[model samples]
Target: MPLKSIRVLDLTRLLPGPYCTMLLADFGAEVIKVEDPMMGDYARAYEPKTDEKSAFFHSLNRNKKSICLNLKSHEEKQYFLRLVEEADIVVESFRPGVMEKLGLDYQILRDINPGLIYCSITGFGQTGPYKDKPGHDINYISYAGLLNLMGERDGKPVVPAAQIADIGGGALPAAIGILLALIERGKSGRGQFVDISMLDGVLSWLQILLPGYLTNHIEPERGKQTLSGGLACYEVYQTKDDRWLSVGALEPKFWSNFCKTIGKEEFIPKLGEPIDQQDVMKYEIQKVIRRKTLKDWLEAFADKDACVSPVHTLHEVIASPQVSARQMLQNIPQQTNSLQQPGIPIKLSETPGKIRSQAPEHGEHTKQILSQFGVKEK
Candidate 1:
């Protein structure tokens, strides 16, 4: 209930912005999802349906209310501005000039309420040359040089299953920025614009790898980084049963133990050597891992010093003991039944985030929210 008193006007439709607002809503913020009257959030119509709503939409948009309006219209714009007067935060994920064209940019809203924290999540940000360029998660990551660093060496860069740029790049940073801005607002008695660019966020994630490249003036290639797939000590291997396990024996002791236990003692001395000099160690380890089933290796390494782990599937992930112990999954009570969903990641001992309600049907709370905000429909 830490943010129970705060109200957030959520104008983000898709992943990044909605995910950011979802975090706020989870922590007890009054998140009013502002949507266009004609179609509402495009996510409401997204695929992979769960009963009547989208499983995708439900995953990202729980614990929020919906309000329908046409920001382009005078009356509705005025109504939104009126709601802004009482709102503590506004979150949107439009391109650079959309809000300005709609006459609802940060400056216009700031004139209405000086303490409003307005956050804009975009691909390239408002000031860059690529500001007006249209892009998605893939494009943003590629632009940030992140995509070039992923996948096998000399192979095509593989797209990750998850939206790293959208969720990690945009949403997480936007959430952090909003919180920091909120804290600053408490002291300054004024709010500021939070411009969250997915490209910038993705670039910041290269802190560890960038140091080497920046110091050496060398461009890091895909799968060549020390922690990536460049070394035999830190990699994945297939088992006899065709299942996979990961090896993270980066230290000397761990590598020695791993090689000795796997009967590849010759590899212990070659640990952390240059790729061309001892790349055969990777093949030797793969052969060793493939000789035994996944379960066999798991049992063998269960009590060992080697940092080995099973590469779990989705079902295995859901049933993981660590996941259960951490409460990463929970049953959220919906209308008549309980729907299982992801739990709050940030653990607050006393004021933990809660899923108070399921995602509203598009504009489900329009009348009620308008009335609550004292904006009577004309």
Candidate 2:
């Protein structure tokens, strides 16, 4: 595996940093989750537990080992420094100065280990007006202007079901930054700080929309943009069974194919007409789609070149044929019985990511890891 020889000391307890380290662990990196001896990860107490263990925690912390320690203690601080000396990467999601307050900031860690790739995942980043402000996934997206752009036309913006700010904005960017820093380390023989802000990450996702807003000096509103449901050819329509189907026939060819397939050739030229005309066409398309069941529409478009697809529920998506074929779900070996969990997303011809083990219990390997790292417990 690519990261088999790499060692990551994960100091994150919740979503963003844990998720970042989880990706590394899946790719065969040695990820040691360092948690507080008292509570461990707060996710362990998250609701919807199985046999008293948090399912949420299990989902994020798989393929990693756990060790407990008090960072404020003098002895434990020295022990952590020793571990840092051997670590290739260190990830933390604390506020701006939390690590510095604990005497474990990058500056001090670099003195002990020059080749340390230190990654800091925060809401606003290490230096910003809101650096010390606390926030979660929703808050980050709200601040980044992403939340305001997510709902219906003229309706109040809806909270996203997915934690895009957490996973997309923070975790994925942190992983990418760490990988880039590691590559740079190979050439420079020195490590660097990787600052990943949820706000910055979310803003980066607005590449398409931001340019338009900046260039035209027009503030893009919710559901008013082409990709945001302003077009008749690129929106969701409800089927007769009340299930939804997404129609994304945005291109000319796809729109033509869809219009012909649905026996609505008159609507072809109205694909991207003015907003009022598009709304009229959208209503007509919705009425047509409502005459058929979701299953019927799926079958009708099965052989068509139109970009139409069913909007599946979570359960339906889990059992989908494409998802099964892609191996997006895997059986994780837990202490009791094997449990099905989300599989690694990135597919590599060589050195592919794998789920080596289930999430570790709190402080499950503290003594063993200490022994392996040559730190004698006194």
Candidate 3:
């Protein structure tokens, strides 16, 4: 494994920080998750717990050790500082000053270990006007102008099913920053701080839209553009059986072929016209799509040049032929028993990742982890 000896001290809970640590763990890093002694991660209490463990908690926290400690305690704080002295990375997701109040901020950690990569993930950032404001994934997306581009033309903005702001904007970028800092540390032999803001990540994802708004001075609206949902060439249409098919005939040639396939070749001339005219063509295409079942449409376009595909539900996605062939899903046995969990995502030929273990019980390895730091085992 690439990161076999790399040690990560995880002081994050819930989604973003745990997800980042999970990615590192999958690649064979030694991740020690530190949690509050009493409650642990709040996600542990989320509904549908099987044997006192939430699926959400289990899903994101595999292949890691858990240590429970009360940070407010002087003895526990000393133990935590000892752990930092030997760690390569320390990741936390508290609001700005929480760690400082606990006397475990980056400056203090660096004093213990100058080569430690201290990453802080938050809603806004470390030093912005909105840094102290309480916010979540939805709030970050809303502030970044991403929400305005979603949903129907005149309807309210619809929340996307995926946690784009949390995972994409926060976790993924934080992971990348940590990796890059590790690389730089090899050259300089010094570690630095990584401040990752979810709002910044979300806005970075909307860079393409930002340029258009700046260059053309046109404020984009909900479902009023090709990428949003206005164009007939790229949108979702409901079939007779109520299933939806995603039609992404964005290219000129694909659009022409799709129009001919649906017997709407006459409307090909207005493919990229004004929103009103495109809506008319969209209605015509929707009417044609509603006349056939999803299976019928799938079979009809099986050999065609059209770029159409059925929107898959979670179950269908897991059972998909492509997913199976790519080995995207794997069964990870439960830590206590032989039951399995979801497999790792990325595929590396030589050093592929595996789900070595399920999420640990709270404070399951507290004594062992503290022992590693030369603290007396409790």
Candidate 4:
């Protein structure tokens, strides 16, 4: 209940913006999701529908109210300005100029209320050579050098299954920036603009790698670096049953312990060797791991010194004992009297985020929101 009375105008449609607002909403903010009057958020049409509503939409947009409006209309724009007068935050995920063209940019809103925390989520940024170029999560990751470091050494670059750039880089960082700006506003009595670029976020995530490249003159390649897939101590190997095991015994002591436990004690001395020598050690370790079933190997390292763990599939991940113990997953109840959705991630002793309501139907709160501004319902 930390943000019990704070209001956030969510003008973002897809993942990044919606996900960020969801975080704010979880912490007891009154988030009003403003969608297009006709199409609404495109996410509403995403697949795996239960009853003309998307499971994807429901998961990301819970604990928020929806108000559909035609921003192009002058009357609606005036009504939005009135909402801005009472709002603490206004988040939008459009290209740099789109909002400005619509006259809803930070400058205009700040003129009305100087304490508005306006966050703009984009691909490249507001100003840059590629700022205007259209990009999705994959393109942003590729531009940020993250995708270049993924995949097998000799194989094609593999795009990660998760939208790391979109969710991690853009959404989470934007949310953190908004919170920080809000904290700063307590003293300054003013708001500021937050420009969250997916490419910038991913590059920030590569802090160690970038510094190493710049200082040591080491041009790290895909699957050829220690943290990537090059090191024998840190790599994934397939077992006899086609299951995979992730080995992360990167520390010298852990590597020594792992080499000894796998019955390849002789390879302990070669742990710090070059790639060719490391490959010899890796081959022997792979052979040992391949000899056993994933389950057997899992038990063998259950309480051992080896930093070994079985790579779990999505189904296995949901049912994992660790996940259950952490209470990371919660079942959100549906407003349509259907099944529950997944719960919020972070846990807080005070002001924890909660799902107050299911994602609203398109424009479900439009009439109510308009009435708040003294506009008569159509």
Candidate 5:
């Protein structure tokens, strides 16, 4: 409801740009997705489909309109400019200079509407040596030195299950930048360019690791830091049933509480010992943890503040009590079946967001949108 009057013209496909606009659209902004007439969003063809619709596409593209337009064509490009005249934001995720080549970059858009917030979400950024380099989430994380600190002490870096670079680095930052730009526009009555690079985004999250290396000139080893895996107090231990339990009793008091609860009070003082000594302690803790099932540990620490929790699978996560209480899931009914989608996480007491509609089919609203803009599609 807060952004109900805002209009966004989204020219992004795949993950980052759509997700940024999806956040805006969920908050009651009018988002029109511009796609190529032939392919639309590339994610439409991705796997894990339900009733011929992409689950990945449906998750990021709800509460938005769609219109297929070939930016290469003179007529269609002119039509898009007409739409931009009334739009408050324009988001794109192409490689650098792609939009300029198509004559639809920010400079051209600003000529039509000077108050338009133009956001470019790219792999590197608009002005960098690697600006034109082709990359995905994994590549961005690797370049940012995040991948080096993710795996075991001597093992190779593992690909994360989460899209940290795409969603965290790219999408969320773009949304934040757009919001700040909008606020600034209200004061200055002028819009500016927002350049978001995924590499920069992923690297910015390395606050502790980067600072430690810079200050002490010591390279951090993987899985050897206090929080990564070196300490017995903060690590994942396997249960009797092969399920994992995350033990995060980092503080001395919590560590003592956990040790005493498990009838191992002697392990309390070894909380922040040296790395080799901590490994021995971790091995001992793992042996003790393996004696019980996850259910047993849950019951044992049910009333304690030891910061212990289960590492749930995808299915368990969806049915979790905390996720349910927070209302982080929604079921939207399609014509043939119901599609369960992720609910909006930004909860505002007065102006909460809603899933107004499902993702639009390719060019589903093309003619209607053109008609409303007084421009008939050729």
Candidate 6:
């Protein structure tokens, strides 16, 4: 309940912006989603539906209120501004000039409420050569040079299954920025604008590689980074049952323990070998791994000092004992069925978050939200 009185006017849809506000809303913020009148959030109609609601929409939009408003209309825009006067935050993911075109940019909002923490989650940010250019998660990652470090050696760069650029680069960073700005506002008594570009976020998270690259002009290829399958000790191997095992036995002690556990003590020192040149070590490890089922290896290493784990599929991840114990999944009751939603990960001893309600229906709280602000339905 740390954010119990903080009000957020969410003017975003899809993944990044909603996810950022979702983090806030989970912490007990009053998140009012001011969606487009015509389509609401496009995620509502996105595929993979359960009981006529998009699972995508259901997952990211819980613990929030929704109100469809035509920001393009003079009357509704005034209504939104009225709500903004009482809001502490406003999060949007529109293109650079879209809000300005509607006469509702950060400058306008800041004037109306100097204490408003306005955040813009864009692809390239508000002031860049690519600011006005349209792009998605794939384009942002590739432009930020993250795509080049994602595939097998000598193979084409692989697009990740998860939207790393969207979630990590955009959503998570936006959330962090908003929190930092909130802290700063308490000191200065004036809020600020947070410009979060996914491309910049991608580059910022790659700072670990910057020191070497800046000094030696080193350009790391796919599968060459120490943690990205560069060594035999840190790689994925297939088992006899075709399931995969992740081995992170990077420390010398763990590597030795893993080799000895597999009855291949001779392979203990081969962990330092490069997978591309001394790939025989990996090949031998793979062969040994292929001889056993995943369950067999799990039992063998149950009490061992090896850092080994099964590469869980979606179903296995949800059914995992650790996940259950940690309360990472919540089964929320919908109209006709229960939908399993991801639980809030931030655990606060005094103010822990909970799923207070499911995602709202389109414009479900329009009249109530507006009337609360003394702006009647016109």
lDDT of each: 0.90, 0.92, 0.90, 0.87, 0.93, 0.91
Candidate 2 residue pairs in clash (backbone atoms < 3 Å): none
**For candidate 5, lDDT tens digit of each residue in 55-128?**
99998999999999999999999899999999999999999999999998899999999999999999999887
lDDT for 244 (candidate 1): 98
Stretches of candidate 2 off by over 4 Å are: none
Q: How close is candidate 3 to the true structure, as a TM-score?
A: 0.97
- Which runs of model 4 end up more than 4 angstroms from their true locations? 335-340
The ten-residue window of minimal lDDT in model 5 covers 225-234
Candidate 4's residue-wise lDDT over 158-260, tens digit each?
A: 9899999889999999999999999999999999999999899999999868989989887898887888888899988888898999999988788887877
Model 6 per-residue lDDT tens digits across residues 1-378: 999999999999999999999999999999999988888999999888998999989999999999989999999899999998999999999998899999999899999999999999999999968999999999999998888888888899999999988999999999999999999999998999999999988888787676779889978778878877688888999999999999999899999999998888998867676556547888888999999999999999999988999999999999999899989999989999999989888899999998889999999999998889887795
Worst 10 residues of 2 by lDDT: 332-341
TM-score of each: 0.97, 0.98, 0.97, 0.96, 0.99, 0.98
Question: In lDDT terms, how accurate is model 3?
Answer: 0.90
| lDDT at position 171, candidate 2 | 98
What are the per-model C-alpha RMSD values against the true structure?
A: 1.2, 1.0, 1.4, 1.4, 0.9, 1.2
Q: Is candidate 3 or 6 superior in lDDT? A: 6
lDDT of 1 by residue, 1-378 (tens): 999999999999879988999899999999999999888888888887776778778878999999899999999998899899999999998989999999999999999999999999999999968999999999998988888888999899999899999999999999999999999999999999999999999989989887778899988878877888999989999999999999999999999889988998888888868987546888888988899999999999988999999999989999999999999898877666777878889999999999888999888998898888777877
For candidate 2, what is the lDDT? 0.92
Error of 1 at 189 (Å): 0.5
Candidate 3 lDDT by residue in tens digits, 1-378: 988999999999999999999999999999999999999999899877766789889888989999988899998889888889899999999999999999999999999999999999999989968999998889999999998888999899999988989999999999999999999999999999999999999999987689899899999888887788989999999999999999999888888889988899897777779988888888999999999999999998998888999999988998889988877776767646553456777889999987888889999999888877678955
Per-model tally of clashing residue pairs: 0, 0, 4, 2, 0, 0
In model 4, the Cα lDDT at residue 8 comes to 98
Give the distance in Å from residue 103's predicted Cα in candidate 1 to where it truly belongs: 0.9
